[model samples]
Target: MGMVLVSHSQARVRTHDKCAPLLPLPMMLQRNVLSDSAPILLSILLLFQNLTISSNQSDGSDGEVLLKFKASLDNPAALDTWAGPTAPCSGWKGVLCGQGRVWGLQLEGMGLHGAIDVETLAQLPGLRSLSFKNNDFEGALPNLTRHRSLKTVYLSNNKFSGEISDWAFSGMNSLKKLHLENNKFSGTIPATLTTAPRLIELALQDNVFEGEIPNFEQEGLKNFNVSNNRLVGQIPRSLSRLDASSFSGNDDLCGEPLEACPANYDGPTKYDYHDDRIRHHKFPETTIAVVAILLGAALIALLGVCIFLICRKKKSHQETAPAATAAAAAAPATEDLNQMERGGESAAPGGSEGGKPSVRLLTFLKEDSEKFDMQELLRASAEVLGGGVFGSTYKAGLNGKKMVVKRFKHMNQVSKEEFNEHMRRLGRMSHRNVQPIVAFYYKKEEKLLVTAFAENVSLAARLHGNQMSDHQSLDWTTRLKIVKGVAKGLLYLHNELPSLTPAHGHLKASNVLLDAAFTPLLTDYGLIPIINKEQAEESMVAYKSPEYKETGKLTKKTDVWCFGYLILEILTRKDSGVEQQADVDLATWVETAVANESSGYVAGAAVFDQEMAGGRHSQVEMMKLLRIGLSCCEADVEKRPEMKDVAEKVEEIKEREFDDDFYSSYASESDMLSSRGLSEDFRSINI
Candidate 1:
């Protein structure tokens, strides 16, 4: 039997054997050739149609995710390239496409505002890098656990706050760099962050995190920080290898790099020791009785001596009263006669003729000047520079020499001996960065410090004050050098005087005077020890750390915090303003700018000094400096890097700038050579 076949669109057509028997087999075979391949052809067409549908579905899903993300923005004008019905894979801004799907979304520094649409953006199956740095994005962090393929999540410099969920980073095993610095994030750092086995860098500085730092001993973890936070307790032993700056700002923290924990200290405890049995056992009966008898005998002897001294002082006062009155009446006339003859120099006033208080010039260095008295200081030509937290400062000229004199306004609690000790300590410090106290005057009514006058302006004046027409504005290179110099000076103070005044308790831009060569000279060092706590607080209000507010004590970390703020001030040229205006601080302003910039807009540029715009500085390099600045200003003091680390980082930035310049020049020279047909010679020189 023979069969006949025919073709219909996508359907098979065959003739039965009964019908086929009527036709010749060779004729049917020749007629059925077209029909023979119908099934295979139809199969190919159907397969192609299914593939088209699948592709359309994927494209539609990606488009929907992107649209939803755009809809979430508070300002969409910055993302004009993302408009229209064009597919994201075709050429959307910040959207990278690969393998027929969205591969990356790098919209950093965009003026995008509002909360991020993390769920919608996570729908893109191939998305690897999502950067929202320097944006105005607010609200709690979105759930990113489902985005398993994300490698880099840069959400720094934002207003994102609230405690991050413990499971926030659970599924992000592929993440390498997670930068959340300069944000308002609060609460303890998630332990889940340590679970991310592949994380290379983690920056959580400038947040409000509390509690002990979690152990991040992972082999791959290289860079980490939690500085300027309210974190307490010892730094994790695993992290002890990091620089002291990394844990600088947390006042309550203690460990090897910082002040060691006291021997009896067992962390924060609620209960006091009031047990009778334990007290009695510690102090045996015989020892306690012997100590009590000795104390009583000492008290009796002290009382007897007080009576004898009081009687003798009364009799002496009665006898000396007449002579003191006669001396007081004649002192002014005698001083006027002496001043007229000695050309304004006279004996110090307010003392008796025979018992005049002698003026002593205590100095750490050898004194070459003739014996000078307090009368010389009073007679010197003096101009009031300004009043500061410590006291009023004066520029004085005496014997053709200029010096800065600071008269203490609120150091009454410090005695003569204590003031002398402080002056000697400061005089002994001869570091190039620290301003040495050349001489000091101690009296019942006044305490004064004398230091060499810096010929150039202070850092504060250079940054915030009006510029002179003849003087050039500080370029990026100069600014960087100043910052590095300041860091070095602070490091020297912290390292050399860790036991005395480990931190510059009153570090401010105004106190950082620049010498003729632009070298930073730290002033107001070692003042915290001599000033009362109340005075210290009032004087250092602008530079005080958050922990200082609560504990009323300053640490090395506090100085780190102040330095961080100073860096921001230098970069932005904005006054920290009054403490009443919390949002006006350079830190908050910088953080906001950083957040706005992360979304692919240039919002962060708003905080930079306008003059910096004309310089040859790279925006990328500026951003790196901003990050470093923000890290120093971290709310977690323990997470702040030491001044040494900061100096090194700044040095690294300078080196990076040099490298960039070198490469750029090299490339330009190469291009010029290529145009001139001398590229072969240039290439040969490389060999």
Candidate 2:
């Protein structure tokens, strides 16, 4: 007799006559139909014929399993794709087929109902995974021990009830992930789960399981949860390594990660009190009466003293009323004289001065300018720089040093603590491109932030301000440098300050100032958390991103959108006109220009600043930047590139420009040397 081995691909079979004695008798009999004994040979032939027939009908068996499973569904409408032929491998929804047989079925959230036909499904010899999660399936989970091929099973978010006995997962050595959460299963979680040596993830949350949690700590296990159960006793020491969230809602569960169990306490117990051991005592009535009379006399004397003090305070106020009025009237004149000597205008009436409690200036930075206090800040020569949605900014000069003070208008909602916290966080940030806050003053009625004055000008002024004869128009190199600096600054804010939501929520050209060397300095960073939403919207309306109206929340993506507009403003040297009656947004205008140029109807140079275009600049490079800007302003927030990515791309562009210039210079030098050599050769030939 010969032996036959079936290959994994069931389509192939091989026979080895020499190995006949090595195989079992039944296997040998089945493979060798021409055995020495006629009876044995005949029996083996009959069995082989039956196996051939079964192999040919296995697809039909799989189709039957699918049809039965579909029938068990309460809502046929949910399985619309399960209609037509029962050829699951070809057209069935959620059916995965391999090696000419069904291997996986996922019917998640398909409105399935009734118990799954585990016995019928087990008939599919190749089925390896099953998912019925997020459905209406109910009833006790059937025995899955027969389905040894299953590797993953998800039965979560259902109404499967009853105790999952120790034998439920018996012999399932190949199972890897099992999700049984959000069910009605009760009783202790079976310690038998440790039998599955390959099991990795087990989720049993939101069940009615009680009793002490079983210790099934296996080296291969990675994720496990039994939260929202009635389990008692200390958590297994091995399982304490998992997150506390995994064991939460289990009231009686205690130990290591959780509260330690009481040393002398067993589980819950009842106590009985004996009434026979009780005793009572009484005090003398005359002693209590004497104490009450003494207390009444003390209260009468205290009341008389309080009344006399009230009359004396009223008389004192009456005498001071006229004097206070005269002082209040004369205070304005003194304030004017002080303002004149300080080389600045008078502080606004009803400001942080005028009979208010003096506040101390809080400085987060350790700069020399921190020496000035609240009196110096109030007395500093002040002139209104401008007023925006948040409030007005003032250019204040104290002694010889100059600074800018931003006084918030409608920030009454922000408490003093929150304001100080925001200022401290901002001051801690140290970046070349970010403007540092020197000091801040917070009061109930007023809040002011002081920062060093940017000596050059703002990006807005450089681009759109009235160009004086002495002022040089920002060249292409300077503009590119400014954009790169702003992007790098934003990237720092985004990465270094994760706690600050919507990092640089109000980024705009006006907020970007230029230093003496024309380096871009970003101001007003991280102000969104403390400012009023309505005021933020009203002031930053011009730079409001596309998602602002829809989400009504500021996000880092919105800041990216504002950065995109800032790029457009710098390149086109035009404002978005959101603050005016102009209907065209800067981004929209640039997009239209790019579209026309891409269509070959207009030169790409049309979208660039005329001063830059008139100079030697790459129109191709300008178009590339325009494309980037458009991507940042995309209506979809998710599509916008992160600030880090933006910074990298801008850096690449900057490097490319340097390469172009280097190559241009090299070519010019080569031409000059060649001409000189030719002239020398001509002179030698003439001689």
Candidate 3:
């Protein structure tokens, strides 16, 4: 949506007039404000210094992750340049982070190579942006659907092959920019994928797609590309307006701006050419045969004409056919819709194909169409409630049978195959505090995920004042237990188990599904990364790392920062505990917090009251955790920690809390169920 008009800067007629193109753009914008070159160099140096500092300090407990990432970079010089001391995170090249995590990992055109594993990157929860353009990467793309906060994914100019399958991008609904141009992929483009609501740019040119182009009409696509493929036949006119370049280079492709095949070349050129040869090679014999047949046909026709005339005359003499004969001879009972159009009645619109319409009947019919029944879902939900991202406190039910229904929003951006893959993956996930997905449905493009909905609100809900006043809120001991339980879940995702693929990419309070026993169940664990294509850029501003605003790359440390933020949100029932802008770095808050700790510095009392008050954890401990978050949000990748260390420290913190009496008070009575509601279930899936 933002527009930047760039031209040469040298032809400066005057300050009010347009400048010539030869002058530098940076100089043109700053010339009037500054008279010397020293300031510009200083500013540039500061920026670089900030990057170095961010890279060095990011991901407090995940520095191992950074080291591994740095080792994979093509240009090791970048590591030396940006990983030095005294450098500021803002000055780092291709590094961005917020609240202490590595959020953006844009190393475009750095000549990065070597085999890459997506699992290494998945460790960073706070990552929301990634870019690896113009590289020598090979093999299939890494699965990034777990990073819930991700918004931009740029992986163009690589050596990726195979068909673009739905499983590759299972939950990337919040993704706004997906650039996969200039690859070596083949096979038909999945029809269900083109309808992402948040998508703005789609560049799939120079691939080998061979089927009908999927529908891209409804998406907010400002740019599209499908050229240089094996695609044949007429291009969809709906996409014709984009640009000729988008559909150019396919020899078999025709129609729209491209020229159509010549009208003369009809009925397969080979057939006509062969027939013409037959006409020419046997001309004499064919001519004689035609003459003889014409003579014979003339004699026969004369005789037939005489007979027909006699019959016609006799028929004319006879009376008109009887009504009974006419009735008996009426056309067969097969439907003649064209005749019906002229006289027969038209049934009412929206009626069932079998009979009259009713809400109950329609619901029943829709259920029958699926592999399950409707009434069974209503009865189970009356007994339990659950919660996740879209909101808090959703009730479950089943009409009569022992079914479970968990209501959710139709995040219509998810494609059918992607949703199914995500559900299957989620279903297989084994964790004490994570709910497994069963099945989901999408009707009219609305996405609803059916999971084993837990029976209670998250601990954050209680902290945020969601429970009844007399309901006896969680005591400090119970809160500590809850933290430990959640920490265990995080540890499992971060380490503990060697994952075959990435785990939860997004960690947020709203995603913390809770059972009646107060056990934290992380719902939508892997959905965040996949649903990145769901909303606009603005909608993701809150959850996205500061680095994402500049270069889009999600690092393991980014997840660390998000986990830290989740920790804050849990402790303080709020999402905006810290906010960082693209232009103004997150380090500002870090520096302020650090400065206030000095003896002579004047501390902001409000910040102190909110961040360090009451019988909560000691300021040193809180600051340690905050620093961990800040380190993870550091603008540099090399500075972040590995999840193993973070999980260790989190475990330590939780173990210390379990000794309190509050840990003994948690309720424990909920049984996990598989399927939820039917209509609500069917209407929400996007396949």
Candidate 4:
């Protein structure tokens, strides 16, 4: 089953460490007076002395239990990180722990299959949460009632077939959320849901459950979705308050949120409003009587509305001018790149491909750039580099210069004057770490921004590209240089866009364009004010901040979180896609890989990218940066360091010089490389 989210509430296990410490001073003073009590004191000391040792051994057992579970999987590579000696409570993926004991396992989207050994799981004493979402689990589930402490169970988006027995959840008294969506469960929603008093969220959508929904009476069941099932009959009164969509896709299910359920049926077989005589009309006689009067009154009202509309026509047009310019300016403002896909340019001056209107020469921000008008742009040969939620980007060869044209929609939240003012502010930005806005064209509906074409690929390509190419994997020093540049660029944006929600609303590895020298240039900065706020939240990286999800607000620390994600991606040579088979949220994955609370140290060949390994000194510096990255990715915005402080932290990680022979032994010969936005590729042969 595919799960969207998972959480675990944990109560710390009171480890037996609180046994009376060896307070020898107190005993020494009382030794002479309490000499007669020596036998009792010796027994007490021995009992406590053995208790701590047993607690340590128990903690280690949790790892053994998880390793056995991993061994049972059909594809063990999914749990490769679980193979190491790292304690399950310390750093193993999907293993959640608190107070040095495992309490939960979040194994969603791990591409897992095979029998889930319920007996093995019962070995865990306090395990409270289990999310097996988006896996390949098939056939009947094991007797989960054996482990009754389970609280949140997510088994959504799986191939598990057959009806769930009513006794499946029989003793899960602590259960709070149960999701079985996108499966083949039949018969009916488990009747045992009513037994769990604390149940709050239940999702049974997209399943084969039938025979009417169970009457769920839990007052705390605030979230329930049973849509797209074989449910029939009236929705239970207890669930009538749920949204209409929750009952959609069930053709037979009807009531309050849907149409009234046939009004007890057989009330009337047929009716006809087209009948000429009132007797032929199946509707009431009074309804026919009022029809003539209503039509007369409606005619008189229509005459009044026409006169009123005529009087207000002049003022209405005046008011609408600011909301929109000439409609002929075109609504398809994001097709400049699509023109290239058609195999040739539109001969029309303003790119007739999308009906874009011809304006004068565009506003140029740089003093030395050769100014070109709409006519020249329409004639240039262009190729689309990329397209996303904002719009399409085109790499155009215009007047012998390589230029990148970026088209954007949904920038009309502000008036034309204010939009131009924001563009001007962006143009004034002049840092090497920041992508310069060379020119811009603004309309009431959309915008076109231009900049110098980047000769190298984006950081995302360098990091994730699967093609065989020289310098596919980066070295330590090069990665350090890219992230340091990123930090500095972020600091500059924070200073410049002090009023913005997030200084760079779309900061991501793909958004960071690297120059030939592998220098990071932050793109798409400070547009939160102009972009449609709803779309930005859905599509931009800034809203990925944990606080935004919890509070529906954005802050400068959102940029910090994005930067932290980039740092972790660089260190792990991984992407940040949440559902990618080979990757997870880089920050969360890193935290799990090295959460060594017992030792306060995470150093092994597994923690860093094996290809990026330099001398041991390099690992020390990488550790410092990793710590800083984790700090930036903190869930609490207040805990995240200020962007200024983060910049200083990055700058302080000095990559010191080592002896020539020692450096050559561990470091790559190609120390410098062309920038790929996600990773910089330095080819030794080219150097």
The prediction achieving the highest TM-score against the true structure is 2
lDDT of 3 by residue, 1-687 (tens): 112222123223354364445644444435543556567675775566566555556654444555567777666665554554423234567777675566777878877776555667777777788898898887776666666467888889988888766545544656678888888877777543453446677778887766656546433577888888767666666676776788887665666677765665332233222243653465688899999999999999999999999888776545466533444333221112122223332222122222221211112111222334222221123433444444223333333323233433435566655555445544545678766555554433334445554555555456564445545455434544565676677666544212212245556665676677777777556555345354523333224764555566545455555565565444344443443344533334434544444332122111232421323233223333333444444444454455655455444432232221211112111100111111122212111
RMSD of 3: 23.0
lDDT of 4 at 515: 79
lDDT values, one for every candidate: 0.67, 0.69, 0.51, 0.71
Task: Report the Cα lDDT for residue 684, model 3.
Answer: 22
Q: Write the per-residue lDDT of candidate 4 for residues 534-649, one digit (tens) a residue.
A: 78777888776778889999887788878887898888887776313234567666655554322322232256777776665675567667767767777777666668767876
Residue ranges of candidate 1 with Cα displaced over 4 Å: 1-356, 359-372, 467-472, 541-543, 578-581, 598-603, 613-618, 655-687
Ranking by TM-score: 2, 4, 1, 3
Question: Model 1 lDDT vs. the true structure?
Answer: 0.67
Candidates by lDDT, descending order: 4, 2, 1, 3
Model 2 scores worst on lDDT over the 10 consecutive residues at: 662-671
Poorest stretch of ten by lDDT in candidate 4: 678-687
TM-score for each predicted model, relative to the true structure:
0.45, 0.49, 0.39, 0.46
Off by over 4 Å in 4: 1-337, 341-343, 349-361, 468-471, 578-584, 596-604, 657-687
- Per-structure clash totals for the candidates: 47, 1, 107, 16
